[model samples]
Target: MKDDSTEISARRRYFRYAVFSLTALLVMSLGMAIVPRQPPAPAETPFSERARAAALADALALRAAGQELAGAAAGDGGPGTDTALDRTVTLLTIQARALVLPGDTPTASAGTGPGHRTAQASSAGVPASPGNSATPGPASLSELATDLAASGATRLTDALEADGGMARLLAGAGAAQLLAAGEIAALAGVPAAELPGWQEPAGPSAQPSPARGCTSAGPSGGADGERVDPGTGAGLGAALTATLDAEHQAVYGYQAALTRLDPTAATQASSLLAEHLDLADEAETYAALQCTAIPPTPPGYVLDPAFLGAPAAGLARLESATLTAFGDVVALSAAPARGWAVSALVAAARRTANWGVDPGPVPGLTLDESQLPALPDRPENAALTASPAAT
Candidate 1:
């Protein structure tokens, strides 16, 4: 009888232990269910990095195309091959400097900028190979134009706006790319009229006085105003005035286009008109801060007859002209002013593309008209070339 009692006691102890273990497990699981876990954070891309990557991609593509062009030119002795190659090299060199390499200053001049990614290659005074590695695959001239018009200028614009030593370098580099892209587009057979500013007028070097017989005169002072000290002004006063005048022309052109455009096209025209007006206002405000005279808006601007019925083409031409003026501003302005001009130029190129205009090989710079085939003689077209006035 005593042995039977002992066995029962042991069995009871084992059953209790098993129940306690089960309860503990259940409590633990419930606690775990009640608590939420935090997620891992996402990685952020640095602004400088993003800008450098975009610029590197284009530099590679441009260098590859340039090599092919050089080869073809060498084999066939083409007339413009050397010119194209030279421009390509100059552009690539500037882009190489804009790559945001370690130890590079953001404000370095493109012409004398330093970079480490291709420091060795650059030291040799050659177009640094793309990525400081083997050349990328071939890119056609048309492909280059498309790439540049699509993203190159805008990417550089971003870099130009970023804070630091690099932004200044990007401004110069970006401007050069805009000029080269337009020139290349023209060479690729894009219509001359399609890229109004792509081809340089006969006497681009001559800066006419805005005061002389100023038909399209504006508010404060004219382009004829005396030159200020380059050291102190960085040419901001003159550049701001020029840009404001261009903005006025843009506003007027877009306004005229809005009246004739179809509903869909009219909306785009209206938006651009407002944008130009805002830009004009901003320019004026900046001029005031600098104590410079703001040019007044002209009474009327000249527009092509074609624009009266079909606004798209006319608006596009005006945008191209504005783009040219901005490029010139970039070339002449300093630091912040140049950065602003770069952004404006990028926007203008985008607008021109929207209006059925293909940004030529060089979107912003004027090319020699001789390179293009002559257009059919139109006396009316003379008005288009007669003056760089309002229209």
Candidate 2:
């Protein structure tokens, strides 16, 4: 009887222990249910990265707007309008393709032109026109002009925050947009002064240090003096010197061309010549700030006999060549030097146009249009061709 009683006590102890464990587990689960768990916070995007994405998005939108305008022009406007819109579209396409992220593969499709995503109707304070719709309607020329100017202004603002290579591209793109804006405005009979003007942004007071392995002293000396090698790693100093060299050539070209030009053309040439002289002085000041050796200007530059024969065409070619030098300055220097370079680029491009030559899509960038990345496939843009403005 005592053995049976002890066995019952053991069973009772085991039952109590099981009950205690179950109660504790229930209490803990209830406690857990009452407390809220927090989720992990998202990582912050860097400003430079954000700027790049914004630029890409803007490029896409501008391209779409250009396409819309082209279509409208085709239906109602004259051939001149069609031509201008086509060129503008081409420029926007190149910019959009260039702005694509390094590793993000664009959608592949046969004969795909500049891809159009369903982006915001307006970006960077630019108002959306009727053309931004999914089923876009015809837009007025005046509205298109306003959009281009605002878009260009936004690009310049973004350029201030982008990396070196991107900054250069953005500056060029911005200048192109502004140029197109003026052209479109002219077509619409809008006053050029009414459009947005290029304003230099505030930036680092001091220039960034030269690239690693670069020295103030250049690789080789010319007959004039120790010429700064404008090669890679030569930094802003070399770039400025190179630009000064180009300016020197431009100055000489204008002087030579002035003699051959008609009286009216000569008057304009003389004004431009004075401007070139001022530009040369400005380039020298920047070079001196960098401690780069400035070479003496040659007494004369070699001019093509054909160039001498047709001074106007030659002047256009000369102005176009200066664009590369200015672009290098845009890439290598920070503001306000970069701002200066951008202005120079715009002026040169306009001058090229003034001389009756089209600056092609991109003025500063020498691109092989054939090798540029094909536009990515977007379901929304299935109906768009690779060149919406083509013939």
Candidate 3:
């Protein structure tokens, strides 16, 4: 009987140990089931990458635009003679280049009041003023362009608008004033509507003139004075007004694209459409200031049927064409306006690329030799690099 009791006790102890082990195992299993699995490591943000590329591209473009403006200013034998505009251009150029070039410093002042400025040239030969060092990258380039554009717009606009300032600038009748006016306004982010007044009244015509320099003759006059050149004073303004008309047409194109784009693409298409509207409005503002009868937008644009079938491709083609148009005007424009046109070109190029189009080596300008097979033989091609007449 004692042995039986012992056996019962031993069996009971074994059962309790087995139950405890089973309970512990079950609890562990339940805990694991309730715990959440970790999500995959977050992917790199698409915006960040795009921002970097855009910044770099803008910096490069701004630098190029600046150089062109400075050169034009210098050619006028006014503010550019002292390299005031050139110095400013150089400073901005260095800052832009530094953003893309590794081991280069971005610390540079935009220069102090007017042309009397001091700065050292970067290794790339662009002037750079001393300032806080910048982290050389896309973000830095974008930030620089944004900050400079904002500050420039405010100060320059105020200077031009205040107490006969515009009148005084225009009265100077210097090439610096004519060419730099649009560029300065562009840099300041001034709207086209706010463009400064012209001291003289003039108009533009599409025909080419024989004169090497600008002629004050009527739009159809045969004299060189009738030709459209920066020296003529009237052509640049006319070209700008015409550009505004082109921008107006661009808005229509975007609107058409929005109708055919996919839901996913429509979101981007809408944003692009809005941008075109703003550009159109700005263009009109400038055109109105010229006192020219701004060309009204046509009731409808003839969009390609292929674009209606494939909205993306159509939009891309439209962007490319606009970029080319802007480039055509750039060749004819003087300082400030020329720079502004370049910015438009860059923006169009970016949009074109977004639509899966290759913008080519030069986004806006067709400087490619292979593309211009007959360009070399044309006597007019020599003037292609020269300042263009208002078309």
Instruction: Name the best candidate (by lDDT).
Output: 2
Residue 213 accuracy (lDDT) in model 2:
30
Name the better of 1 and 2 by TM-score.
Answer: 2
lDDT of 1 by residue, 1-391 (tens): 9999999999999999999999999999998888867778878756655555545444544554565666656646355756766667655644554353544322211221111123222211222222222233344565455444433434444544343333434443454565555667777776423422221112122333434333333323343442343433535566677778888888888877777888998887888888898778766665554456565578988887887767788888778777656665555544455556666766777788779775443455544444433222212101000000101
Distance from true position, residue 264, model 3, in Å? 2.4
**lDDT score of residue 362 within candidate 1:** 44
Give the candidate number with the greatest TM-score. 2
Q: In model 2, where do residues sit more than 4 Å from their true spots?
A: 1-41, 102-136, 201-231, 378-391
Q: Write the per-residue lDDT of candidate 3 for residues 151-208, one digit (tens) a residue.
A: 2222222222222212111111111222333445444465534532322112232222
Ranking by lDDT: 2, 1, 3
Task: Residues 1-391, candidate 2: write the lDDT tens digits.
Answer: 9999999999999999999999999999999999988878989766556555555555665676678778756857787788888887787788777766656433323422332222233333332211223443434677567666666665666665566666667777777888888888888899998875656644345543323233444323212343222446557777888889888988999999888899999999999999899889878766765656778788888888899889999999988888888878877776577777877887888888889987766677777777777666444332221111111
**Candidate 3 minimal-lDDT segment of 10 residues:** 382-391
Clash tally, candidates in order: 22, 1, 10
TM-score of each: 0.44, 0.73, 0.39
